[model samples]
Target: MAKQQVISPLPGTFYRKSAPDQPSYKEEGDQVAVGETIGLVEVMKSFHEIKSDFAGTVTKFLIDNEDAVMAGQALVEIDG
Candidate 1:
């Protein structure tokens, strides 16, 4: 099996939700499809969607929510 890559589309702090009190966009073992929005990256108060590059089940979460992330950063790994 190959691990699917979840990439950050911008340089910012990656957040799992629109608000702190909200649940995460996704979690491990969750089935995801290509082009699906998995998370958000905040840059200068603007949020950008981080999408899945492949269809698979999420196997790992590389970065924690609210963590500073760079462009192209690996956010999650999925088993494809």
Candidate 2:
């Protein structure tokens, strides 16, 4: 299995859920495809939908929810 780098498109805080009490968009081992909404990033009070760019299982999540992230930072690792 090859590891596909899933990078953040913009600088923001990465979140795993739509809300604090809600379930994460996904978890490890979940299968995802390109264009699928995987998470959300909040920047300047705006919420941006974070999507998968590859089809595969979620091998890992490189960034923690609510963590400040930079543009081009790896957020998720997909086995594509």
Candidate 3:
């Protein structure tokens, strides 16, 4: 199996769930499909959905929920 990384598209705050009380978009060990939303990035009050570019099992999240992230920062690692 090879590992792939999901990168942040823009500098902002990374959110694992759509809302505070909702479940996370993807958890470790979860199977993710291409174009699946794994998280969101909030910038200047605008939210952007972060989607996967490849299908694989979610292996790990590099940053915690609501953590600050930069553009092109590695967020999640997926195993294929």
Candidate 4:
């Protein structure tokens, strides 16, 4: 298996769940498909969905929920 990373497309606050009460979009060890949403990045009150470009299992999350992130930062690691 090869490891891949899900990169953030924007600089903002990263959120694991849509809302505080909602479950995370993808958790560690979860299977992910291409174009699947894994998280959201809030920029200036605007929310953007972060999608995975690779199909694989979620291995790790590099950024914590509600953490600040920059464009091109690795959000999660995936094993395919």
Candidate 5:
């Protein structure tokens, strides 16, 4: 298996859950499909879903929830 990285497409604050009380979209060891939403990035009062580019098991999250991120920043790692 090879490790694939999920990157942030825009600069924003990354959120693991849709809302404070909601469960995270994904977590470490979770199965992730291609085009699946792993998280959300909020910018300029708008939120965008961050999708996975590869199908695999989520190996780890590179940053914490609600953390500020930059475009092209690695958000998650997957093994496929």
Candidate 6:
């Protein structure tokens, strides 16, 4: 298996769940498909969906929920 990374497109606050009370969109060992939404980024009150470009199993999350992230930062690792 090869490892891949899901990157953030813009600088913002990363969120694993759609809302505070909801479960995370994805977790470690979860299967992910191409174009699957794994998280969200909030910037200036606007939210943007962060999608995976690779089809694989989610191996790890590099950033924690509600953490600040930068553009081009790796958010999650995928094993394919």
Question: For residues 3-39, could you state the per-residue lDDT of candidate 2 as single tens digits?
Answer: 9977899999999999999999999999999999888
Cα displacement (Å) at residue 77, model 2: 0.2
lDDT of 6 by residue, 6-78 (tens): 9999999999999999999999999999999999999999999999999999999999999999999999999
TM-score of 5: 0.98
Give lDDT for model 2: 0.92
Segments in model 3 whose C-alpha atoms lie over 4 Å from true places: none
Superior by lDDT: candidate 1 or candidate 2: 2
Model 6 RMSD in angstroms: 0.5
Q: Which lDDT value does model 1 have at 4? A: 69
- Compared to the true structure, candidate 4 yields what TM-score? 0.98
* lDDT (tens digit, per residue) of candidate 4 on 1-80: 99999999899999999999999999999999999999999999999999999999999999999999999999999998
lDDT of each: 0.86, 0.92, 0.96, 0.97, 0.96, 0.97
Model 6 C-alpha lDDT versus the unseen true structure:
0.97
Write model 3 residue lDDT over 1-80, tens digit each, in one string. Answer: 99999999899999999999999999999999999999999999999999998898999999999999999999999997
Where is model 1 more than 4 Å wrong at Cα?
none
Q: Which parts of model 5 are misplaced by more than 4 Å?
A: none
TM-score of each: 0.91, 0.95, 0.98, 0.98, 0.98, 0.98
Compute the lDDT for candidate 5: 0.96
lDDT (10s digit) by residue, model 1, range 21-61: 98887888889998888899999998788888899899989
User: Which window of 10 residues has the lowest lDDT sum in candidate 3?
Assistant: 47-56
Better of 4 and 5 by lDDT: 4
Off by over 4 Å in 4: none
